[model samples]
Target: MAIAAKHNLELKQYDVTNAFVHASLDREVYMRMPKGYQKPGTILRIKKALYGLRISPLLWQKDLTATLTQLGFQIVPHEPCCMIKDGIIIFYYVDDIILAYGKDQSKKAQEAMDQLKQRYSITGGDDLQWFLGIEVIRDRSKQLIHLSQVAYYEKINRLVDDQTIRHDTPMATSELMPREGLATPSEINRYQRKIGSLLYAAVNTRPDIAFATSRLARFLANPSQEHQQAADRVLLYLSDTKWLTLRLGGGTAMQVASDASFADNTLDRKSSQGY
Candidate 1:
């Protein structure tokens, strides 16, 4: 997304229908026929890869990598899932592919996509809007791109009851100490679920909650009411700032800042650092 915004490029998404079924099998495999499709006392030999098999993903990846490489797309050394040739970049994740290219190279990108469409049942040729639950909004005129998870946040919010209170910060200023007693089974399960959801949001677009989420995660083994309240505070904060998004491509220069504290962790008494 940042690359698209930086180059003022158009982003296109494509989905390969029945992607796993397309890859040819390289080994002998057999499966029992369905109750209705069974021949009398006979099993079926597997031809194409099936979805449930463990090796299916490997077969698909090998096939895709071979095909893309044959078409002159080079696999990025640092990011194996990314394929690039000229100015056209293709980011492949399983069956989903995102194409990014500048206006001048749009034809080349389309041609590559067309070649893939010829081989597989491709379903998309529209502007990139949503992928992996992240909403992408681009503004070419202003040279900015925003990534948000409002829908995901709302979905998580629905998991819990409505809250009249909202928080400005994800966590309180005071540090949290480990509770004295172990949480009940149900309490532990619920706390872990909430932490998992919040962690996803943090890793995706809500970096503001990253520290709080991480801290809460430490108590997942035996969460307490106070810890649960901290988790709720994070959710309340999300409810209030659901519209917050990560913006990219405002400037060319890269900037970095660092800070550290000695023995900040109350439990471990270790220095904490961040950038």
Candidate 2:
């Protein structure tokens, strides 16, 4: 995204219709026929990959990878679903695809997409505004993109019923510790679900809450009332500042920053670090 914004590149989104069914099964498979297609003493043979099958995703990935490779798009070293041809980058997850290219390379990008359309029922050629639940807010004039997850935050914030109270910080000044007393199964399950949702935000667009979420994660196995309150506080904090976004753009330069908590963990005396 930074690269796209840096070059003031254009983005196009596409979705492959019935992606799984497009791939042929590499191994023989059989399934019981549906009610409407059932016949006496008849079993159905699966020739094409279907959605519920275990190998369907793999088959689709292989087919798409081959198709992209055939179109001269080289797979990125660490990203199997992301391919690059010249300065244009094409990334896909499951059926959703995004194409990014500068104005100068628009023709080539369109040609590559056109090639893909011939093999797949590709739809959506408009500019990308949303991808994988993250809203892509682009400012071409400033050459920047802001990634926001406001809807996601709102969805998870319902864990706390009372939205009247607001928290300015993700965590309280007091340090979090392991649960000392026994917690009921229901309490533990509740905390786990909240932490799981918070983890998504922390990894995606809420780096500011990473430390707080990590602290709350320690008591997932057995949470106390204080731990639940802390988790709720984090959600409340997010509610207060739901509009915060991560900026990606300006220049093609790399930046890194990290900090560590020195021997902060009482359970193992191990330090926790953030990047």
Candidate 3:
């Protein structure tokens, strides 16, 4: 949706039929019959890509490229996973495909989708509300794409129900620093697992918790009471920012910055680093 809103392009989706079976095999293989064959020594020769093979997906992609090229679609020179024809562009990640074209050229784009459907399954073209866990909201007139993680935030809240906890800073100032021989082994392990989940969310859709999550993660091997307090603080913070969103700007670049503090550890007098 971001790409469509930014470039005024229409989107479509397609799925390949038995994608792995299209691969041509040079080697012969045989498998035992499944309980019904009369001859015990009988063997079946393999001619196509099979499940669990390491090269099936790559081979399927090659077959797809050849087929699309024969239909006059030029693969994108820089991106082997993308293709173009006239003004229409399609970007493919594995089997999921996203189509982009001018607003006036929607019919032609549908024609292209139909051709693809003749060989594959075209699942969608309109009202794509969600993709890859990011909620997509499209504003046609404003030409904007808004991606939110309200669902993710709700999941966090359910996991850590701290309704009475103060909606203050995620990590208290005291817990920001580390001390030697403070955290027990069991406590450290449990806290580390919780902080790891928060880190994943921070990286994907919750930048607000990055600082606190990183600070708590540092003490994973020896999490003290301070670390536990800090982890709870993040839960408190989430209580208030559950609906917070990172908007997709009209022309914004996805850039990130990290910083470290020298001698920020009050307990051990150690410097702090962040990414």
Candidate 3 has its poorest 10 consecutive residues by lDDT at 156-165
Show where candidate 3 strays beyond 4 Å: 13-87, 161-168, 174-196, 217-236, 251-275
Q: By the lDDT metric, which is better: model 1 or model 2?
A: 2
Please give each candidate's TM-score: 0.91, 0.93, 0.66
User: How should the candidates be ordered by TM-score, best one leading?
Assistant: 2, 1, 3
The segments of candidate 2 whose C-alpha lies over 4 angstroms from its true place after superposition are 161-165, 180-182
Among these predicted structures, which one has the highest lDDT?
2
In angstroms, give how far residue 229 of model 1 lies from its true place.
1.4
| Model 1 / residue 170 / CA error / Å | 0.4
What C-alpha lDDT do the candidate models reach, one value each? 0.87, 0.89, 0.70
Please estimate how well model 3 matches the true structure, expressed as its whole-model Cα lDDT: 0.70
As for TM-score, the candidate ahead, 2 or 3, is 2
Clashes of each: 0, 0, 2
Instruction: Kindly provide the TM-score of model 2 when superposed on the true structure, using C-alpha atoms.
Output: 0.93
Candidate 2 C-alpha lDDT tens digits along 1-275 = 78888888999898999999999999999999998988989998999999999999999999999999999989989989889999889999899999999989989999999999999998999999999999999999999999999999889987974565567788877777777789999998889998998999999898999989988887888998888888888888887898899999986667888887888776688888767
